[model samples]
Target: MTTMEPQGGFSYSEADFRRVQDIARREAGINLPISKRSLVFSRVSRRIRATGRASFRDYLDYVSGREGQDELKELICVLTTNVTQFFREKSHFEHLEAHVLPQLGEKLRAGGRGRLWSAACSTGQEPWSMAMSVMAELPDALRMDLKILATDINHAVVETGRIGQYPAEEVRSVPQRWQDAYMEPMEMEQVSMAREIRRLVTFRPLNLNREWPFKGQFDVIFCRNVVIYFDDETRNALWKRLADRLVPGGFLYVGHSERVDCIRECHLEAVAPTIYMKKG
Candidate 1:
């Protein structure tokens, strides 16, 4: 195989690219195709510079070693995409507000516990949006047994979620009603989520491809825009695991481009575009 010319002052070979593909698949269950070769070079090259490695081979060797676990994590962090915003894919949240929250609200108001999981919750927006939606219907949700769990594979983004702060512009995508009620202004044109809203969400670092620590079914699970990186087998297996984690009649919202092909096997039924409901 012809070696690709060096870019960013680092040599990247087809063999090096294959190494990255193998590591990404093994470490994160991500599938990297030839189309991602340039992407791999561009992103991983920075890691090379940061870690003072001479070339892609050196960097790959370092990350592949037994003592390279931390660098390996950094590599995964940079390679994985984390683009997200408040109320992204508005339809999902709208459906949550209109259909899901009402039933959960009733249960919570009747002194029952409810849980929502924002798997791959990038930067806390999705779970915070969920908290707001729950508050909209149940104003006293903070006093209820309902809560949202926000998790991400990247520890950095998970910390950002735990902090519950975002730039003012990022919060604009949030509904004005929610903005006013759940957000407070900060210096530097940033906004911090109100304690009430933050209190309703628990942020933790979680790798979806790995074992889940806690054991409980969710009333709603938002694993949106995440599985697109996985190959069919990994994606299908993840869908089944997610389905198993849902309470009967629970809702699962995914990315618009993603579909749950194991609906019958998982006891899930499509209820809307990118939404599935576990059968009762």
Candidate 2:
């Protein structure tokens, strides 16, 4: 393979790029095509510099070795995008308020348990928004047997969610009514979620590619926008796994651009755009 001469103090070759594609797929279920070659180079190049590796090959070798487990986590973090905000994809939240929450409210009020999972929750906004939605519909949710589980592959972002603090500007996207009820002002132009809201959510590190630790199912799951990184096989398998984790009549919300291709096989039916319900 002809190696391209050093573009930014490191020689990157076609073989190196293929290796990256394979490692990303195997480690994180991310599929990188040839178009992402430049992106891979740009992002992974920083790792080469940070780790003092002389070339792309050297950095790749080090990260592939047993001693590179920690760096491997960093590579996955750098490769995956984590852009999210409060009530993003407003339509999903709207549907949750208009339809899903009502059903869940009844179940919780009747002394039944309820669970909501933000499976790809980034920086806590998704689950916090979920908490706000629950509070709006069911003020006594904190007293009920209901909880929201927020998890992500990135440790740093999970910590951010656990802390329940965000830049003031970021919280501005939250509805003013909920904001006043659930947000507390802090110094340094930051805002903290009130203990009431924070208490409703649990943040932890989770990789969707791996086996889940918990065995229980969910009433509603928000797993939007993350599966686009995966290839067809991995994406389909993930969809099935997520479906298996949904209780009958539960809802699965995905990104606008994604579709649940295995709906029939998974016993799910499309209820709305980007929304599917597990059939009883």
Candidate 3:
């Protein structure tokens, strides 16, 4: 890749884009194809301005330098696309209500705990939506040791989820019953998740490409949408980790565009569109 002159006051080149893409792939397991050059330039351009760097090359050098660990995190935050909403994919939630939760409820009644994971929980919507669905079926879920772990690699978004607030428009897709039972009005045209719903979720920062610290197995895991940004190898590795982290007969929910065919070795059987079950 040859170095090209600056275009549109953004000093970028093929080399710079490749460097950024390589870093993103290695550091975050996110694949940045050449088609995303413009997107990368736009997202990374902001960091150049923020860091007062002369160009993308200089910015990349700084971020890859010895003192760039924190800056690298900022870069990852900016690069990740977090497009999420309440009940974004209705089918998964429908399945949760219809089949998964009832099975999980039986386990809970048998003195076993129920654990759900929103693996790519962007700004609280997914996990909160999961909580609402679970509550509708199991009203005493929180009292019965039901736990929801919502995790994301983006620090900013994880913090936003921890606050449990969203614009009113953002929560419109949420069912009326859920809104009535689990939403509290907030200023700025927003609403907050009710304590009962919020209490069930614990938000944390996690990188799916890295080792997971928890040894607990989840009864259902919602890892939707985000994996599309990763390459096949990274995606498959994550699928295995998800399989390992799930309890026997646990459900795995993926994005509409993602498939779990590559994880056959994990013994995860596809039970429905974008839903997989770990075989005992």
Candidate 4:
């Protein structure tokens, strides 16, 4: 048995940090600046302890070696933040209710299917909110050809979204109307999203840097607060892909702090703050 060198039990070196950063960017298009070194160390340290590794160097080698594909994904999941709640950004949902839903409803009523995508939908809140807003506007949305595809790169958070249950405090911010219409009381101060609303959303695991499998385009896409972790080039590429995935006149909502300024080839025109419309 090889005796491991302990630099304060769970030592993290600059080399190990750089290696992790490189793998993360190459695999998931996430750019980790030097300021995030502490955050990365804290998160990856937990995984290192969980995996019973002696040092960060050993753990990094294991994850970077041949059999580390799924482990690499697990590492990404640990580092990726999923801080989200129901209607975290109210104006976007309001926009959905006022503009997007009406257009989708008209299409559905006119015998056409409608689709909404909640890309990087952390823990189901965003998609569920979209579903609730849509149902509130169009009572017959489920009966009509309507679907909400909610996807995230993290498998754990994707499972959380699929379950459609949340802590009561986590859901307290939900609007009363939506709470009454779409939530059922769960034990221990928890709430489960109504079955019908859950049915409206289909949860899937998606990595934004990878090629998307589906052929259909979306009438509305809410990909908020995700691209802030990417470099300029990666962010522009992602915006292009998102623009391509949207219907010609479809709506795109992003994070308040994030901007999509210069993807000229994507033909996205800013219509409002943090909102863009795909141009023909």
Off by over 4 Å in 1: none
Q: Give the alpha carbon lDDT tens digit for every residue of 112-164 in model 2.
A: 99999999998889999989999999899989999999999988899999999
Best by TM-score: 1
Candidate 3 per-residue lDDT, tens place, 66-175, comes to 89779999999998999999898999999999999998888888888999999999988899999999999998787788899999999899999999988998888887
Tens-place lDDT per residue, model 1, 1-280, is 7688575787778898899999999989988889989998999988988999888888888998988889999999887889888888999988998998888878888889999999999888888888888888888888889889999988889999999889998888787878999999999999999977888899998889999999999999999999999999999999999999999999999998889999999999999999999998
Q: Distance from true position, residue 102, model 1, in Å?
A: 1.2
Worst 10-residue lDDT window, candidate 3: 1-10
Candidate 1 has its poorest 10 consecutive residues by lDDT at 1-10
- Deviating ranges (above 4 Å) for candidate 3: 1-5
TM-score quality measure for candidate 3: 0.96
Scored against the true structure, residue 48 in model 4 reaches a CA lDDT of: 87
Question: Between candidates 3 and 4, which one is better according to TM-score?
Answer: 3
Model 1's alpha-carbon lDDT is: 0.90
